[model samples]
Target: MCQRGIKVTHVSKGSSSTKIQRFIPLANGLTDNMKSFAVFLLVLRYLSVSHGCTCMEGPQQFPAVQIDAGQGNVVMTDGNNYAYFLLGSQWYKMGSLNLKHVSVGPAGIWGVDLNNRVYKYVAGSFVFANGESLQQVDAGGDGQVVGVTDTSTIHCLKSTIASDYRKQSTLSWTTITGGLMYFSCSSKYGCWGVNSLQNIYFTRVTPSTCGISGWIQVDGLAVMVEIGTDGSVFVVTRGGEVFQRQGIDSSTPQGTSWTKIPMPSRISHVSYDRGNLWVVTDYGTILKCLY
Candidate 1:
């Protein structure tokens, strides 16, 4: 039958036309082997000669809670099992990722990538996967969507349902004069932007209370910053000094307070996950905040 232009070769003559099935790419990137009757085919056009694709062979799993993808990776979960993966440009099923996002959520539900692309799993549905360039493209959900662009702009897309994802509240913010991966937003009130100067700055962005304010330089070259749910800012700087800021009426590092997490080392990324905080050290060590 002519299904979406692709010929659906009847694998079974006895199979009814109404029962005819077509191979539709998995929307959440999962191999059929993990479940039962599914297949995930990958086509790498660019990184094939460079960073080869790493395929995972296993069963579909769920997460304990939820997960957030970073730049170019995808997160998958079966409600109790969690998996994160970074595929160059190919396709992968559930439980095939490179890093873990214990901070954003459990380890599943949804995921972010290096390019800031996010996706959700819709079982039994065929979905076309997008490249990392699709960041800030679209997510099929409501709620607040935080999008980051490669052009040093942090955009906030907020809706409120699981299906009304097309109507996003997009607010773009430019980074400081320094080059950075752009700014990271919080669903709370504002977002923090890391500038090209390797410094950290964030301004209020809420609607009623959020006015068009300029950047507030926090410090020099923070390794990473995670805004808490209570409007407090936790910033990690060059020397592993963990600084916390309370409100906008503070000068930062001093206006609020500065307390270093006694890790005795520097870290690459500090993530908050599963009620605890995890930090990846510069030497590839994963350290947890002693809270």
Candidate 2:
């Protein structure tokens, strides 16, 4: 048997009244072991609540056909072939460029031209980074760029310039693999990709082999996957459903169980940074997702 005491204080008219004390007895079925387990679970719940990720909905009237966030900046490409970047809350036009996909990260802004060549935005102009052409490109912090070729081969830019954003001559391309349709990377949590069959794969970024390895299968199907700086993962399905999971960890590298996020419209693209989640609907409506 166990008894726990709790004190309740009451006040009347801003004056202290009486202090009531109560003792609650534990249930007969609860043994000392059960009590200890319950206490452990309570501690875990409190920790998760205090340190877990949070999300909220943001502006609904953002002007862009597609949007991405990284490196304390939000970038969007409008329908007019114009690229706009957001510093703080204001949008600045970065001029016109023929880019089908654009991504911003600590490495700066990267775009893929109609011819599939990769270009890095520098000094108000897009400079060619590498000769290898790709169909899609995603930039990550620490000057990492990953892309998929027209033949579905995955390629990553091997940088010789280190952190220098100006020198494009120091960039070269290396093929990671083939048969991947989409890819995204987080400097903190490596990179993730989805193949033509909607299969997911992950490669850890480390000093060994530039973090490229044979594709490891992970559960879930996604048309797009975006990773936050904190390693939070968000995925958009072909059926327009948005789901999220924590990043790779010792217990669950494939991530925690997926949770469906409610949205007002069908999501066509998704991007996450820190705790903020952004989605663009099929109708070109942009919204910040709150969880």
Candidate 3:
């Protein structure tokens, strides 16, 4: 027996879980032969592994301007100099630091204050992470942090503390060559950034360096880009549309194409993890897309 075309089945609302199944047919364009059988099997396997995922709305809303998610936590700044962290579906006010941007990773959380000073969250308080002022900061699950200055100069935080040492020391900041307006990194996928021109760039993590390559222009204008711990990529366009990459693997370093995820019309920021996607609207509504 042979199927004829691709068919997708999706469940209606009110279900606890949404299940999607994709089927491919071989009868329409192929002759009745063994070759068609083999092709059909391969197509079935591919479709099963790569079905499109969708987003689900979250419970709470906030006046957030920036958001980040890590293994066990999510954090965001409320644009009024206050920050909040989500704990098991409930959001709690962390403090009033007047931060411009914030990020969370496996090691901890990092943020830049209104004056461009970078700080690390330790033991429920913000501690100065580096001396030099930065315009923005981002972190990775492996304790890697990177920042950019007002002049677009790039800097990375290098830990002087030993792995076995219990006491921690302030991280040393070093400047890199490239200039960027926004920067993000994934412990597994290296780093990515957008320059002043809104052009996107990617770098692979290597033993010696963060192998930064040249910038590649993508379709549509992106205001922000975020990478998940597993290398999943998401971007929010200036027009308030959210787009995600077709795959989460690091093999596609340049990310040639994207599929627009159906979301609110005024999304301003986005973050991703292994299980869910989070976004903030221009009016400060926080929503999550669960797969």
Cα lDDT tens digits, model 1, 1-291, are 001111222345644332323324343464444322222211111111112211122222222122223322333322333343325433244543322222222111334444344443435222222322223322211234343456645544333322332222333322223334544444445666565456776665443232325666764467556654333455667676555554343344223444444433344545332233444444333333323
TM-score of 2: 0.73
Clashing pairs in 3: 3-25, 81-98
lDDT of 3: 0.65
Per-candidate local distance difference test: 0.38, 0.65, 0.65
Residue 11, model 2: Cα distance from true site in angstroms: 35
Q: For candidate 3, lDDT tens digit of each residue in 122-229?
A: 778777654578988887535657778888888766532211113234555666777788877777756777777777776753313333454455554576788888
Per-residue error (Å), model 2, residue 214: 3.3
Worst 10 residues of 1 by lDDT: 41-50
In angstroms, the error of model 1 at 15 is 70
Q: What does the lDDT read for residue 246 in candidate 1? A: 47
TM-score of 3: 0.74
Error of 1 at 187 (Å): 4.0
